[model samples]
Target: MKNGEYFISKDKALLQTETIHQFLSRSYWANRRTLAQVQASIENSICYGVYHGTRQIGFARIITDWATMYYLCDVFIDEEYRGQGIGRRLVDLIVQSEELDGLTGVLGTKDAHGLYESFGFVRDPDRFMKRRPTNPWA
Candidate 1:
């Protein structure tokens, strides 16, 4: 729970939809991602929020079956909070969580390879492929 000046909580109430919408809409990997899509994702996934007391500073989600595999996604820290080790601490807590035990984990990041690598992630260039929705809004 407590990691230095930050802490991780699994409270969905801590999520600010407007703030998440604004950040993801501008992110290269998920540009223009609609609020409905974001809401749907949050509703379905296991969400973790990083907080400094009552302030939500970061978030991450895992889409998983809990018995086999999990895909970590939407991991982000507020731009103002990046320099601290909060991001790393957040990820470490997730990876070590009992809920995800014994599952193969995967994540996609255009960058941040170094950060993820520290947590036992590696390139699987030949093992992964993706297909985007033909009509994201549809």
Candidate 2:
């Protein structure tokens, strides 16, 4: 695989597991995720990975009802691979995907707001709410 080339976006269960592991190892929000746990999560997600000759350099996942709302999550691009438009292309592919076509796409990011904004994602203060467990270990 080269830039702008991907093997396929479907049948991604196994590939998703690997992609998550690669990301969580580097991502602050998910650095504690174990391979077994990540594998289980991958089995239940609609995931996409961008590859460069068999190495996954970017990844994202969407959890959705497939009818109305889609939460895009875990987007990442390897540091060495940034500025190549891979992240933008990944978002484009997801937004344009027939599987997600008429649903609302949502995501939360501490950074990269500009990138998502370029794709028509806006901060809708009235539509967002969140809760975090007081004791996540429980």
Q: Specify the highest-TM-score model's number.
A: 1
RMSD of each: 1.3, 2.4
Q: lDDT of candidate 1 vs native?
A: 0.88
Clashing pairs in 2: none
Question: lDDT score, residue 85, model 1?
Answer: 88
lDDT of candidate 1 over 16-132, digit per residue (tens): 877777778878877768899999999999999887777787889899987899999988898999989889988999999988989999999998999999999999999888998
Which regions of candidate 2 deviate over 4 angstroms?
A: 1-8, 13-19
TM-score of each: 0.93, 0.85
lDDT of 2 by residue, 31-111 (tens): 777788777766788888777767777778889998899999888888888997888888988888898989999999888
In each prediction, how many residue pairs overlap at the backbone (N, C-alpha, C within less than 3 A)? 0, 0
Q: Which stretches of candidate 1 lie above 4 Å from their native place? A: none
| Model 1: worst 10 consecutive residues (lDDT sum) | 17-26
Number of the top-ranking candidate, with lDDT as the measure: 1
